[model samples]
Target: MLYKIFAAALAAAFTLLLLPGCKDQAKPSETAEVIYHVCQRSFYDSNGDFNGDLNGLREKLDYLQDLGVTSILLLPLYESVYHHNYFASDFKKIDPEFGTTDDYLALVKDIHSRGMKLYMDMETQYVTQEHIWYKDSYNNPKSKYSNYILYDDSAQTKPSTIVFELNSLKGYDGVEHKITTVNLKNKDVLEYNYELFKYFADPNNDGNFDDGVDGFRLDHAMDTLDLKPRLTGLFKAFWSPLLTRLKQVNPKLNFVAEQADWSSLGIDYLTKANVDRVFNFRLAFAIREFDRDKIMAMADSSFSATPAGKQQVVFIENHDMPRFAQVVKKNAGKEKVGAALNILIGGVPSIYYGQEIGMVNGDKPDNVYGPTDANGIPLREAFEWYSGETGKGMSVWYKDTGPWWTDRNMKPNDGISYEEQKGNKNSLWNFYKTVIALRKNNQAIGLGQYQTLPNSNKQVVSFLRYTHQQAVMVLVNLSATAQKAEVYLSASKVPVNRLGSLMSNKSASAKDRRVTIELPGYGVEVFDVK
Candidate 1:
């Protein structure tokens, strides 16, 4: 009788789970405040291994927490043939080099225990030739997995027309350079991907919501999966269904896509592909030029173009781009200026690893097509934890591999490491920590509406962020010449007493609801309205 009762109760629970919107409705943590983007292999190494692993990351949680990061967006962690971890051999298995599955679970648990979020980079569009499905389907027409890949049928040689290219492994010799595109429309492939995504969402299956990852960063999220006319709408057809099913299992799971083109803002992804967030690439490109007008204009357009519930992930640099410090020719002041705009702008701020300490990219070969060539070796160099290149916890994955391995921009004891800048008052690392703390502690700055403030100096980009409870003003001088700007705010909007200065690199005062600030070349000031 008890067995029958248990079975009936199980059936009823399963029925309830199948109902639309019947999943547990827990509010997702606010993800927009700040996210730290980490290249896991270069972040920190544990167990005396040169490769940074899940355990290494877990060990460094205190560092991230102290840095005021609310979430971490990691590069791919799945088993891959390449070093950068994009082309996956298996979606379900954690890379052996990174550690076992248990290590990943422990990291996830630690992140949640500390009230932080974890987001993994996922690329379901392609897989390495070594993947089990690819190996089975590559030359065997009779194999059950044969239809899982896209192939050119017109080839004179059987299956020789398989889509193949070097993905981040081009420059290296003796490495497997072939990768197969997954057939997103295939039913078996879809089921495989659905299960993989579901597993990541709730690994323990206990549904306590404390063990699994919170979300994912969809790499190369394009509507046109293959750029061919026939493949153009596959994303809407494929991704939407997969995402819908994933949401049914875990309603709080979120996804951010790296839209194919940086020049265009991806409003289409929000409406068509059903993604939660897209990177603001146009704004990222504009900020590098240090043009106040262009930056503010792009900022306004991005925020305006976004739908009511959607968000834009804003950053000045990432793994696939040149470092912000290098783009500005290692100008500390201009770097700080860029940092100010990144954190103060009204969107989710993502800080690439080593960006807080002003780490710059090393010299690159001339005319390289991508940021760090096909291998992405230089752009994804080891993180500088200390002034000395050789030290405990240092990730020397690409050390002495080639000229790209040299630390050209950062020198030993140059005041750029955590050891060097942790306590320094005016260090770039401190600046980043303070600004992040300011954004987190102040609701007006992190989760409020943004409006550009009027300023006479075109080089000065001033803006106000406010909510019903509070308001704050941000003024940044994007030029090398010292700038004086009279910032005007409505008395009704920001009362006189509440207009006192909060933080500034330069001196400033407020009177009659107006704040006048004099910024030395590339200076920044942030004011709290009460």
Candidate 2:
């Protein structure tokens, strides 16, 4: 009897081990950690092409990694003709000019292996005129997508008078817009868009997109049209559902809207749409203006404005805009301060491809692309990946590279580059690197409570970041003159041993009742206290 009982007990244990209820189950929860942006390919390449590409970018990973970049926010890699790949022809393949599909896959796999994430820029606005869908829709009148092609309804009215000009509102800047606008009310087309998202999001097509890419930077996210209230409704119908599906597959998936203005509208839409983050175009615009204190004030105000859980994706430049140097022209000093602010302040800071090198568009004549506007301002320039003198490391995109959209080549900004900045202990590059390191190393800096330090001078701005055990003071001098400030910490547990200055690795000192510090023109100082 004892032997029989032992046999039954063992069998029962084995049965329970194979049963669904007894299996180890994963707790379902959705939360993603913060990721800083290492924006890739916002420049002209050296391989004789006007647009930047994959191999050129692969060469710069080490430089980016040295900057303590944890993730890469790549501009659209899909095949397109424009300098910015907003019109995607094929989502499954990388542009042959950029590199092969294998190359892109390898890049993503290698990046992931190294514990870094890659976010692809997605342009859902228009597809190439030659895309299969466009070809099919144009050829097959009976097909479901036939109605997707939007045509001027001049023939609809009883009088049939052409009151509204179709020519004026037909295309994207009149540049061969062929992507048919499908009526979102149509269930079949809505299903196709969802399927497209599923296909791209899926690394393996096992009915669901479980192993797809990490995130998406939705291109032209705000320019939805052809219907009332444009994307706010359609996105909620399509993207919101897809986001929920994607989160189930990978909880770390992130969705970032691009160039979306009207924050209130965007916030309200995205809040219900359940997007993870919204790009802060306002912050970028403010940064361009170099309204220093106003930038901080806006930052504080905007953070308060967003939904309680939503975060902002902040950037200086992306592929579409002119380089950041254009934003702070002849004010390299202010540019540094802007960088410091973006790095230290809340939100994910995105560094454009050429911004770190301080590359500005330089003069190039006979260039279809002209650097100077009617007002004599520099346009987006070719990326100066190296010193002007050519060598083996010269980018292949530049060999036949004509002038860029900005009609210029990358010129040195204050003689700064990643190579130079990495070496200099007090360089702006180092300042950014250190601040990123601090933010990553200290939870207080990343998730702590924020309070703006009182500043009497309008040109000087300061803020305090604190958590239970740590506190940091960030001060920026917005003007071209040195400024003195007295800072007081209400908390009695003041930090000692001076956690040190971020810009210069100089020893930091805060004694007695207050701390007095002097800031250089367009300078920034950080005190990381205990």
Candidate 3:
């Protein structure tokens, strides 16, 4: 009887081990710690020629790492007719002003050696008149590249029906240029773009991703590709196929789409285009106005819409949008509130350069309109490294004499430079650093599940981030007056010892499974729960 009982106990233990293996597996989570979006030309100047370059960025790796950045998203670097580097004249070469191919390769190697990834921006939807394909195909019916670009036959005979007309480049004047859309259906065009993407994904072709960019940001990504009705569904037909081919060459390659429209938030790109990520513009816009309800609702909606494997790129400001500092009138409290929401929210967080120091765009002329307006120039000013006008890492590329540089934004003793904020504990820059450190150090804030918590105060926004091993509670006061609120976590009881303030502008206390915190106007608090 004893021998039989021993055999039965062993069998039961073996069966229990097998049961765990049979259960359904959880989906894998995305792993992007933090992405810093940089406009290279305006970031830093290594040559002191006033233009920021790849070598300039290469020199700042330590500075970036100190700020808890794990990835760098550079704006377009391809040879382009414009300063923004969007209208590419050659996809294979780096812009001459930026640097040579060797410079870019060295930068990539340096970034990877420090355990960080690089992503380049690419917009292949349109081409300037200076592009080789456009130059070769222009009004030349017999040319091999004639079918590569869309053209109107009536434009050849009737000047009034000309589809090709001169237009001013956005953010600059006295520089009118003609542009045409590429024909995505054309086999040659498709093949050319494919090769361009593959080249950047592995420039050396040695299968070492560190030698080249890890991914590409598909600018102006859309389904139709153009305004014409016939162009609809090109993303499904073109992008999906191109992405598949690129992945086969380098399975680790990733793509983030700049969805054409920001009002609607969905996973259509991930589901239909098979892309990896999309910008959460709705959340970004909501955060700008400090709308607590809208921000919480949008955050929850974005989390639900994105499937388990895909991710959303979250940000409060970028090159195209108004600076967060400018929008909030440079209020310290408001800036801190925005920073908390950006770093603590679910999904990957990307910080626009200069945002950490509370940089604001200079006042603009009143008559300007659209992104092309001259007023947009101040939004892309040089980095203020010192309290003075000129110093190390300062790139006054547009100072004193450019179409967009009528007035300088940085003044002496303004206390908005890195030198000023680096030592000040209460500076906006330090707040960003501290919050980012918390996000990086805590796994729950970066990769765990997100849920909006219930609160009676309209001015307070509370949420929970948790995984099996960790849980975090975040509360924010959106108004400009001191506020008090209680966050009830009845569903998940708080452990006595683990309940404490991680980072906050005010004091907080825990009692009877509830967290009661007092926040000054535009204040924020992050708590670690059991």
Candidate 4:
């Protein structure tokens, strides 16, 4: 939660960023969050079927805990023919290949034992042909599920798809998936979604949440059902009521919505829709562009836009879009700079699977029109567990299925695997490990107020994360050249006695409270100030 964001502490500025209903509560040092967004199908395989399973993920809890990841945002695990698992064939059943209900419960229990959260991905806006609702109502208007599934004709034979009435989509696995949109306007469908989500929150009908997920990620969450609304204002009419019922089951269960429009700021989802979080898509794109001015401007606005109790989920890569490593052509320096910002920047941060090890994507798609051009296949490849790219838990489910496998993301002896980088102190994996530790160890970075300090070098992104007692200064050179930056500190707030580098032994010089810092090409450095 982005509980209390303080205003910038510059020489000419001082203000409190208090929002509604937050005047009486006492504020503590805020928590630092490192949310690891993982794709279970590619993470690890325990059953030796070339498909990753719940048992494989459970076995890796130690790895996640050691990296200081406070939460896990898992992609959908429902039994769908598509590899991404978006259009679920069954909402209630865990894919047989993934595991049984017992396996899921055990994983949730283990996550809670380590004080980590597990958020389930729930995309119910559309369903595959095999879903019970679609099966019962596709051609029979008199069926009980008639109002549950959207139809384009009064006959109910023409099932409506989401957005432009698209009845089907070709997935990355080279299959055309016929899908049907849900009639969210129906009272029965609304009740069903709430019940299904609540079941995951407290399975076995027990009040204890140990065997349940901590939250739900609402995929492609919309207010008016793709703007071709049979009912308008679903935020208040549909989503608000649905969420209210779930909160009764678990008041603290977090809800994150993926705004349907990627370009939106998604403030309405927080204020009107009653959700707890929204993806900071604007900032993610700006960071990829890497323009110094754009990053600073967008970062400030995106971090400050949310209301008091809501948070913006900041991230560089997810299951969608190209990986940060692939975007920069595997530049080591740029990779470090991008990874640091993802963790240390304001708001709750998320890292996709294999991102800590700097996983790169495969060849770009030559066409988007056919199953032959399955672009997302490369992005969802197997996790590199060994230097040879072959191991006990290697999940290459699509290895021999397509042409994309010829130039897949992982290569033998590329040094991007966890096996080789686990011991190398300078590797990207350890760099992420060290950065996460730094955030956890310091309250200022995790919970304190944020300020974008002005500096002489335009290429350097300068900022301060400070509490009343201490401050942490972060400097990153966005360009490919080394930069020396000068920033004047505000002397009126607190007396400065010491300034030291947190990531290295390099010294900083100060005179009259002005500081001079040196940053290498695409370098990121943090300093502890007292």
Q: After superposition, how far is residue 309 of candidate 3 from its true place, in Å?
A: 0.7
Answer with 1 or 2, whichever has the higher lDDT.
Answer: 1
TM-score of 2: 0.76
RMSD of 2: 14.0
Candidate achieving higher lDDT, 1 or 4 = 4
- Which pairs clash inside model 4? none
CA lDDT, every prediction?
0.75, 0.55, 0.76, 0.79
lDDT of 3 at 298: 94
Off by over 4 Å in 3: 1-32, 154-173, 365-375, 490-498, 504-513
**Model 2, poorest ten-residue lDDT window?**
157-166
Q: Write the per-residue lDDT of candidate 3 for residues 377-442, one digit (tens) a residue.
A: 566688778888788768887666654564657777888888899999999999899989988787
**TM-score of structure candidate 1:** 0.88
> lDDT of candidate 1?
0.75
Tens digits of lDDT, candidate 4, 442-528: 876776555676778888887777654456778889989989888767632334446788988976756787788888898898888
Full candidate order by TM-score, most accurate first:
4, 3, 1, 2
> Model 2, range 428-455, lDDT digits (tens) per residue?
6676677677776765456554556555
Candidate 1's C-alpha runs over 4 A off are 1-32, 154-174, 366-375, 406-410, 488-498, 504-515
Q: Comparing candidate 2 with candidate 4, which one achieves the higher TM-score?
A: 4
Residue pairs with clashing backbones, model 1: none
Model 1 CA lDDT for position 52:
89
Against the true structure, candidate 4 reaches a TM-score of 0.92
* Error of model 4, residue 312, in angstroms: 1.3
TM-score of each: 0.88, 0.76, 0.89, 0.92
